[model samples]
Target: MTPFLTAYLQRIGWTQTPDVSLETLRGLHLHHNGAIPFENIDVILPHEIDLSDEGIFQKLVVARRGGYCFEQNGLFERVLKEVGFTVRSLLGRVIIADPPDMPPRTHRILLIQLAGEPWIADVGFGGQSLTAPIRLQEGIEQATPHGLYRLQRNGDDWILQFRHHERWQSMYQFEMGQQYQADFVMGNFHTAHWPTSHFRHHLLMSRHLPDGVKQTLTNFHFTQWQHGQVQESQTFADVAALYEALQTRFGLGVSDARHGFSLQQLEAVMAGFAQHDEKA
Candidate 1:
């Protein structure tokens, strides 16, 4: 096994190299979600999102900080490759925000073919990330630890939907065209630099917890939910409170000193969310 793979396994709390199988894939997906969080703090911290393998390793495993799609799945893709999984990178358009038009394909998704059966596995997608590998088929509600999800055909494309509020809501859509590292580079740049990209404005972070519980931070609001019901919710009144949640709940810290993320910058940006929450 490669050094990167060994370190990655340790980071995700795995003791030994897992065999290349569906069960291993599912375990890694769930453990990755629990150990490393989904966060867009780099974009909010005003640092460029680095998509290189070494850069991803340093930020995620070495620094022990969470990241958005590119960093999160980029690191996972390498680990899977090292463990002998036939993984393919794919791009998807995120429609969870219900944007007026079909937005750019900014989301980095993964497609794995194990024993001729296709499975979609993702440890990214903040808050609503897939907790296990879902079948890449149409019209069937695949039950995961978190909830039920289904994929539907949209012309020649496919859209992933999940059960919520007694309704299936669209999360993302994509065709089967395979993606490459360059595609993620472009997507990461757009996600970080695009002025209107939500990553620049919102402090989005999430992690899957024990027994169907999910923890998320959207701007200044923090929520803990279990099986689609809110168990606890709080809106931070100050950056100190928000910082506490990020550290204690999500396990992120100021580990990447070169990234220059600090409490002061956090306060400067999250001030907007604090004001917005007060008005709402």
Candidate 2:
């Protein structure tokens, strides 16, 4: 059996070497976000989601498939452990549409111990999550290309806050406690295959750059955000166009069976978003 650590370093685009440092960690995060992509195509494809080390290694390192939170963070933690970093799987809830509500168990994250303090290192969150590890403490802000971020304690759990428009907004909540890999397997399966899950109902991919730029695709529209401004927005009319963009622009490759959203479906979804915006 290949050592889990070796497999993880390869998965993150690093060859097995003795030189590991904080800079290496940062480079790994940047390399992952740039190369692997943050995509939910497996969800729409209804593909089998696996949380095992070997399974994740094959999909990410061998097949070069991109995945959502559980797949991304799950594999990332394995690599950190292999590199002598103390790693623990944690659960988080996204606060995109709601505020201050307890999120579901589906959200998976990592608590990494380095330099005698635990830090948050997440590679799975689609957009605007910390692109590098941030120290887990209260009242201290860590600046990144995306924005200024800080972790605040709320009783037993923690809230990740992002500075936007000169104010802090709660991005997500996570607990520092231990979470088993099997716990995420059920969630991974549910998000990938369940009809009611949002991942199953939509097509989405996103990535954050080191310069604080973000590229995102939802349904048919592609958007690029730079320096807090939307630098580009384009809508494609066919699956071929979307697939081409995925390959050429995003560096993602997957089986054609994963393609599910057509132009018509994407248009309908965009229309729903327009209606929601109008109502708001």
Candidate 3:
């Protein structure tokens, strides 16, 4: 096996044949969602998100770390291609607010064709990420481990919705327009460094637990979700508690030593943000 393919499968905990069938696609998607978390610590720490395949592999696989949409979907796109699947990258606008607003195309997703049928595969959206690939059937509620998700046709665009609080809530929208690599590069730059970007201001981490529970840690607060609603929640008392939650809840390691931010430094930096929060 090629080094990249081997490491990619190992990272996602996939031990099956690398085929382009629907079963293989579902397995890859589900395994990836369960294994790699969605996090933005690099952006919070002011570290630039490298979009290169080698950079992503080294950081996420070799260093045992996680990343945001661009990094996660970027790496996933390459893996799908290496496994003989025809994959194309697409962009989407997050519209979670009350009044639906079309933000910049900041999210990355994949469109894969198998046996002349198209499916949407995404394992990157932190809180509302789909745990399995959904066919391109509009208005169909597809059951997944987390919850039911559907795609609604909105004029020329398609709105992705997740079942939350027993209601269908809009997550994002995308068109079939061909997206280029430059679009993702620009989006990543804005998301990583823009002053008002949430990734720049907060520490967010998420992992879909094997027990059908979704665990999320944002700043000092940790929340668990099951069947589309919050089941339990807590706020860490201190940086130490937050560190423990990081290791236990999200399965993040102590630190990315290659980035020069040791665990102590991480605690100090997070403390700085907490103090700033109080002052604000």
lDDT of 1 by residue, 80-146 (tens): 8888989977889999989999999899888898999888988898888999999989999999889
Report how far off residue 276 is in candidate 2 (Å). 12
In Å, residue 263's CA in model 2 sits off its true spot by 12
What lDDT does model 3 reach?
0.84
lDDT of 2 by residue, 3-45 (tens): 7656556655665362346777777777677667788865555
Of 1 and 2, the candidate ahead on lDDT is: 1
> How close to the true structure is residue 207 of candidate 3, measured as C-alpha lDDT?
89
lDDT of 1 at 170: 98
Q: Give the range of the ten consecutive residues with the poorest summed lDDT in model 3.
A: 253-262
lDDT of 2 at 68: 83
TM-score of each: 0.95, 0.84, 0.93
Comparison by TM-score, 1 against 2, better one: 1
- Which scores better on lDDT, 2 or 3? 3
lDDT tens string, model 3, 156-252?
9989998877799998889899999899999899888778887877889998865688989878889998766789998788888887777788776
By TM-score: ranked, best first: 1, 3, 2
